[model samples]
Target chain A: MATNIVWHEASVSKEDRREKNDHGSFCLWFTGLSGSGKSTLANALAKYLFEANVQTYVLDGDNVRHGLNKDLGFTDEDRKENIRRIGEVSKLFVDGGQIVVTAFISPFREDRQQVRDILNENEFFEIYVNCSLDECEKRDPKGLYKKARNNEIKHFTGIDSPYEAPVNPELVVNTESQSIQESVKTIVQFLEEKGLIKSGISNGI
Target chain B: MATNIVWHEASVSKEDRREKNDHGSFCLWFTGLSGSGKSTLANALAKYLFEANVQTYVLDGDNVRHGLNKDLGFTDEDRKENIRRIGEVSKLFVDGGQIVVTAFISPFREDRQQVRDILNENEFFEIYVNCSLDECEKRDPKGLYKKARNNEIKHFTGIDSPYEAPVNPELVVNTESQSIQESVKTIVQFLEEKGLIKSGISNGI
Candidate 1:
């Protein structure tokens, strides 16, 4: 069946997209516990990049679960499938010549690794949103920790399920201590240093 | 569990993205049978849109099945799931302020309607790549038609399975008669006329 599938060569390649957008395309995969500021940081970075005339988009647990992965649940297998789909979608965005930022708890190391392996060497940047369980629980931005404590939610990362920290992530933002602005600065600085974007007068807050 | 999920509002909205791109964001969904020139026409439009400085991306069966929808097969259930996922992904691109063109066989009207229902009225443009099966078989761009005739493939659209055409598609490109350039010009003219794109000196051939 696979043999019957023919490859259609796209006249416009990723290089063409990048040349048009004036920046390289890649995925910024943010993995961490709930309330670790993954969504916040990802959105902040997206705004920064967008203002800089860089094509950018954000995919997070909230927006994704409501749409593409709506049928998926919180089971371990479902979680893996969720991340897998997001990885593939991110690849598409990168291929379209846009910077895609994805935020998910993504609790397992192998699951995150699978997403990274699907992209080219420099196309996937795994940014571990590092925060202690205590800090995340304290932030309790969505009251998820309270729900987990009350036994209302099962397999909650950092409470019931485990979150395997990235052994060697491309970048680590310690959101527990760093301000959101600082986190955005760190990421934008890395992007500039890597030549993903041409350095300009910083528009990032 | 649902109560624990809070929507994080981004500083950037779809309007912001559109303003930055200097064009409106929407999905140009091309539906037809295999060998109907959907991919060809979609890529042509994408190239045309890209050259116009409008952020555009093409999502077709070949590239999508190889990645995001890799797990899906040609089964009825899988096909429905495939289109559902594509609709959601297209929404993401539209939200990011891009004109996304998707080329899929998407033979089921209900499935196509499901995708249309997911987007705003004007945001989803259903383009029927109209071509008779006999014409497609004659073209036989991928030689799949021969295999289908030999019964080497199961549930081959227009061969064994049914293809429910769109009852009231936004536009129809009769690829059987119209050239690829003509098809692209028709679609681009529609976009410009609908004010989906700002009119410029037509670069289309």
Candidate 2:
């Protein structure tokens, strides 16, 4: 049945918000196996950007799975679907003129590429939290690796499933060796060099 | 089952990004029906913010449905899921210390409230794009109203489904009575009043 009501209408354009924020929006995607320190680096980078007075946000995998993606399981298809949803969300963030950092296992190459395709060129920076599987198991912050090794967990990346390393990442943080300070410095330097942060350097960092 | 590996820590924090960007990260959500001028406003807002040197991005409904929300259909579950994913993504953007403007129909009040809950109290700004149904029908740029009238589409908000009006919005823009110039001015004025923009008003406007 047709109704005479016209419901779709909203005001405020994208250009206006972008002008107010001062920096171009993009997604910083961090991919690695469980316990690879993707969350740690992403959080630190976000902090650095925050101090610099840049608009920013982070998507931690554990937090998301607990809420927005709660219904999703660990099956390969489910994981792909999960990444797909995150990708779309990331795209929205980019549109809003904010730097978006996503920390996820995102073990599939195709899925990561799919996310990149959704945004503008050079907006999606792939940061591989490069840590050996053995290293990640050693620092199992959530004990996920232990459960995976014990067969209590199924389809765990780097245990039963695969983690496709980035062939060419914009940045690769070797979490196994560098101190947190040094890692953050590298990320901050990258943002500064990219001109993402203009004027001051200590507002949102 | 736990192995040890060196972890690289970051020196900086999100505080630094905020200091540099000169503004806090948050979500500027634009809600209305399709062709209600949401995308147009969102895009223009991004542009304006960019010109003012504010970090920004825009998330339009059509653009998102084409990619991140592509796998899902138009069922209620899918719609909820879509908004949920967007909430998560906006959180990430705010974490990155960037401003975000999202334009979507976002028909239901509950769903919109869910997105607001995902954000910090002051971080979410609900900008209701207020336009009467009659004017919206006249501005049916996509001819969607025509399709709905012919029963070519189902579950369309304002046609077959219901649109829960926003009870309290941060800002309301009546696109019908206001010219794009006036509408943009209203938004810029809001940002200025909120201390988001530092540059002077656009002479062009």
Candidate 3:
């Protein structure tokens, strides 16, 4: 305990990075069903934030599954472990002074809570991307829903598996009802209001 | 495959982040025996980089073992997994456009090579913090050497286990001979010469 206090008092690496970057660093965790348009919205927001000069990065299945979590499978145990590692990586990004957007169908309340418990207050913002299962299945961006229907994939959230939504998320966006541009604007506005980022977004955007 | 190209051509998130942060991002991998001043020198270099307005963070056993790689142990296989996870996390930081300094014993050549292979060209810099085992045992910063000597710790690098030094490290600093300030300056100068960072360090420093 004493050592931790001395270390924090002596070496404020997070504070130094935030000051240098001229912004607050935190995780914008987007959770929902598999086909809930999480990747599209998260990438769009990342691009928008980059245009506004906010240091940002996105951690989706594309970058993660093939490398860090390749050994993990779709079993219940592996699902929890996957979310756990992603949460830990998000914390590192937060400490590095960048806004990290993680688009994962983190389907367990306890698992999500574990991540929230690990981060400092105001560092973990749960953004629940809401889309009805019917809608998501209808869209089926990656065709995983069809495979799940054919039993080609097991433990699929909203089909064979369960998706436990956030009990009290910081923000909830229903992508089915809103245009992508409007959804992106709403998130940017929320970030601006929270003072997590400065307002440099051009009016034309 | 086409999607990745389309995404890259459409959006350059990393380039955007680097421009905003005003510096290139990469990993400074510090490998050495325990108590060899790896942590001390990495932290000192981080402090120097932070003063120069370079986004920087150090991932050492203190911050990492308790969080990201908490499940990993000192066994040979776990050690490999530990380094692999750290390498992946470092890649995320680079994508986030921040210089991440990792200080670990990381004794195996193949393990270090795996990290280098995962990163893009110019994105990984292996820094060998060379210290004689005799000097390291004498300093014994954390009393780990005493425990290792008494057989309280097993598979300890430079003791019961072997430490494979880097054959073609980008840089090597002998903490036993050079002052901490001098070592930090040497690193800063190297970064400047490599165009990874600009020479903004004032003469007063």
Best by DockQ: 3
Q: Can you write out model 2's per-residue Cα lDDT over B1-205, one digit (the tens) per residue? A: 0012123335334455556676666888988876678878876766655555556666666666777667778899999888887776667666556677888889999999999988887789999888887777788889998898899988888888887879999999988888665676788678767876553544334
What docking class should model 1 receive? acceptable
User: Of the true contacts between chains A and B, what fraction does model 1 have?
Assistant: 0.26
Q: Give lDDT tens digits, candidate 3, residues A1-205.
A: 1111111112447877787777899999999998887888888888766665567889999889988998899888998899999999889888878888999999899999999999999999999999999999999988999999999998889998888899899998999998766777778778878888765452424
Give, for candidate 2 chain B, the lowest lDDT window spanning 10 residues: B1-10
Alpha-carbon lDDT, every model: 0.87, 0.74, 0.84
Best by lDDT: 1
| Residue A87 local lDDT, model 2 | 80
Query: Which structure is stronger by lDDT: 1 or 2?
Result: 1
Which ten contiguous residues of candidate 1 chain A have the minimum total lDDT? Answer: A1-10
The second chain of candidate 1 has a TM-score of 0.93
Rank all candidate structures by their TM-score, best first, as comma-separated numbers. Answer: 1, 3, 2
Q: Tens-digit lDDT track for model 3 on B10-79?
A: 2446777788878999999999998788888888777766665678889999889999899988788999
RMSD of 2: 8.4
Error of 1 at A203 (Å): 5.8
Instruction: Give the per-residue lDDT digits (tens) of candidate 1, residues B1-205.
Output: 1222223335678999998887899999999989999998999888767777778899987679999999999888999999999999999999889999999999999998999999997899999999999999999999998998899988999999999999999999999899888888789879988999877514435
lDDT of 2 by residue, A1-205 (tens): 1122122324334444455666767899999988888888887776566445456777776557876678899887888888887887777766666677899999999999989887788689998888999999999999988999899998889989888999999998888898666766677667667876563342222
